[model samples]
Target chain A: MDLQVAIDRVTLDKAIDLAKQLDTQVDVIEFGTSLIKDYGLEQIHAQLPKLQHAKLLLDLKTIDEGEYEFDKGFATGDILTAMGAASADTLTKVYALSQSRGKQLFIDMMEITADKTAQIVNHPAAIYGIHHAKDSKAGFDAAATVAAFHEDYPMVQHISVAGGIDLTMAQKLATQGIAESVIVGSAIVKTADPVAAAQKFMEVMHK
Target chain B: MDLQVAIDRVTLDKAIDLAKQLDTQVDVIEFGTSLIKDYGLEQIHAQLPKLQHAKLLLDLKTIDEGEYEFDKGFATGDILTAMGAASADTLTKVYALSQSRGKQLFIDMMEITADKTAQIVNHPAAIYGIHHAKDSKAGFDAAATVAAFHEDYPMVQHISVAGGIDLTMAQKLATQGIAESVIVGSAIVKTADPVAAAQKFMEVMHK
Candidate 1:
């Protein structure tokens, strides 16, 4: 499994610094929804330097105006996310746009019901992100969540699991072979040395 | 009935100019989701002058990170919107935050199923906005939609309807007396004179 380190709720300068430091250590560097909504795609595009090693993902969490958000988001990041709860038309439009532009769309599956999930699983190329809401006080079991989701929809090829992913859970997910990528936020970014933290997670996943 | 004018897909300068002009004419001046994502709440907060007459509503469409988004959103806008499809926990957290601050929360009920709607209809102070996804090519009948919604969820007060609301539709909604507010976007803002168009909408609603 690939380690996707998410940088969130931090200043742009700090986010850029962390991204630069963790670029080589992780497979994908996500500028979290907080970063995108706080600074915007235009400002982020203007400020953030191009990454040399890792892929860039911006958690746009787009629910409506899919084309407009995706059009601007693609200018900066390699992958942009849209909410799975969005209408089929919105999802279809953005997925097609991603394909046409040779970029990727990550469908953020947060608070989406199983019935809704089953219907929107037709995007073969799009990454189906099983996200846990950050604001929820409830406990999240990343591995079990991924396991259940995979069992429910084995057809979804590019699966990614996010929210409260620690080293142990990361290793378990990597071993399970369901999710292609595991997204780590505070565990990696909030550490004393994000680069070192990311390396450790990567080490565990690879081992 | 209240007229909520939505300013979207424009430069920040244009948005501010339009907001300034429409401040007194409309009951509420909405800086749509486009404005918040394009310019950001912080930048908007710093730039936008306090509205002298109309209440400000920023369509944050916040799906997660409720407290963080609401804290920043309430700094500038009298009302902030959250997606109705968000987790129940997220909705509760933001609702409490809004209540604590004595501001309002507008729940954008776009693509939310009837079952989900029944679950989240408890926030009496929160305006339940019956929104049609702009990305969808499906035609919308604003008054009919609001009436149907009201019939289904009679307990839900402070209903706000949006999506392709023209003069006739606005008049019909006003007469129906179910929706307290009708949100008009391009019908007003895309006109030669936005302020004049807003007056025409207000006239129709009042008549």
Candidate 2:
């Protein structure tokens, strides 16, 4: 299992500082959707230093104009995200673009129905991200959610789970052995010591 | 009927220039999603001169984190957009914020299922924007799409239509007496004279 740290809703300077600090501590460093919308890709690309290790993912959450967004997004990061709720044509365009460019596209399966998910699950190279909306007053059991998702669509090889993940849930998910990566946001980024928090998560997940 | 000119895929300088030129000519000046992602909201807020006549709409296309996105988006523009495909919780949060703040929230109905549309059509104050994905290869008839949408959701009073809206389609939609506004992109922004193109659209719609 891999740990993906999501840094969100912070100053670009702070986000860059965190990314630099945790570069080798995690498998992936995600500049969350808020950061992208707040700082813009051009500015982020200009400011963020090259990571010596770990892939960079921008949570673009693109719902349309896949080609244009993906083209611009790939110029900055290794992985970009698109909404699973987007039309089949849009998903196919981004997926193909990601493959051709040797980049990665993560399909955010947020607020999508099973029928819709079934339609888009054919992209083997794409990562399917599962999570409840952050604003929703809903409870999320990450391990159970991943287990159910795996049962529903066993063909989806790469799966990433996010939403309020802590160390215990990370270890549970790691033991369950379904999700390829786990995304932790406030748990790692908002702590008193984000680097140490991230290290703790890494230790538990790899234990 | 209103003419909302969509400015997309251009340099910040060019976009600001276009907005300044078209501010008085159109009812609404839209900074498209591409611009928002290319240049962050803080930069846009710092640079964009306040519109003297027209309202400004930022196509945030927000799918989640509704409160945070809307809070930031409303600081920069009169109208902010949220994806109709977003969860009911997300939509409700943005709609409430928009109403409380005395601004407008446009629910983008791109590629949303009819069932989902039915669920979200109750927000009377919200502008329901109907359009196909710009990346989709499928055919789009703007006027017809609006007509069908209006017939199905009579409760939704404010409607905006986009996607390949030209002078003829704008006139047709205006005459059809359904959509409250028609959004035109390349037809207006890509022309040799954008102000004249926007004037032509305004002429046809208001004729």
Candidate 3:
């Protein structure tokens, strides 16, 4: 399992500093949706040279104007994310664009239903994410959500999960043997020691 | 019925100039998603003067991290767009933020299915937009899409439409009497004369 450290809700200078610090250790460095929308992709493109060793993933969460967003997003990073609930056409267009650029697309499934997933499950190359909403009023059993999603759409080979994942939960996911990537945001970045937190997560996930 | 002239895919200087010119004629002056991503919201916030007559609508096209995006978005414009395809939590969070700001939220329904629409049809304050993707392989009949969507989700009071609308289609949507707004993008902005094109569309839709 590759460790993807997601940085969010911080100033660009702070985010860049943390990214530079973690680049050599983490496999993927994600500029969370907050960074992209707050600072904009143009600024990120200007300031992202710090990510020399790790792959940068911008959580674009694009739904429409796929070509425009994906084209600009790819200019700034190695990977971009789109809402799986985006139009079939939008998802397909971005996926194709990512493929053409030899980059990666992470399909963020924040609130999409099982039926909708069936429609978009054919993207053999894209990563289908089982994400719990950040602002959800409901409960998020990340491990259970992954198990249900896997049972429903087993063909969706490259799966990822995010939302309320701690090192314990991350380890549980690893032992479950489904999700290829696990995304933890505040649990890591908001900590007193983000690098130490990430190292602990990496140890648990790798175990 | 209000007219919103959206300026997109132009240099920030040109967009600002157009917004200034169109501010007097239109009810809303929109900086489309292109401008936001290209120039970044911070830059646009610096360039955008407080509109004396028109309400500024920045098409943020936010798909996740609703609170952060809406917060940043409202700092610049009177209205911001979130995809109907985004999680209910996302839509709800942005809607609340918009409500608190005493601004508007335009929910773009570009590629969402009917079932998805059922899930998001409860926000009476949001303007439900019926849109066809620019990257769609098949032809999009905008009036037809709006009429069908209105019939299905009559609870959704305000409706908006976008996708290759010409002056003729604008008149047709006006006569159809469902969509409260028709979003004309490249058809107006890419024309040899944008102001003339916008006036012609306004005349056709309003007459």
Model 3 chain B worst lDDT window (10 residues): B131-140
Clashes counted in candidate 1 amount to 0
Q: What's the true lDDT of residue B22 in model 3?
A: 75
Where does the lowest 10-residue lDDT sum fall in candidate 2 chain A? A132-141
Cα lDDT tens digits for candidate 1, B1-207:
999999999999999999999999999999988787777777898999999999999999999999999998898999999999998889999999999999999999888988898899999999999874344445547666787888899998899988888898889888889899999989999999998999999999897
TM-score of chain B of 1: 0.95
Off by over 4 Å in 1: A132-140, B132-140
When 1 and 2 are scored with DockQ, the better candidate is: 2
Clashing pairs in 1: none
RMSD of 1: 2.8
Output DockQ, candidate 2: 0.82
- lDDT preference between candidates 1 and 2, better one: 2
Give the Å shift of residue B53 in candidate 3.
1.7
Q: Model 2, residue A36: displacement in angstroms?
A: 1.0
* Candidate 2 backbone collisions, by pair: none
lDDT for residue B4 in candidate 3, whole number 0-100 = 73
- Put down candidate 2 lDDT per residue, B1-207, tens digits, no spaces: 999999999998999999999999999999999998998888899999999999999999999899999999998899999999999989999999999999999999887888998899889899999883344545557766777788888899999988887788889889999899988889989999999999999999888
Q: Report model 1's TM-score to 2 decimal places.
A: 0.95
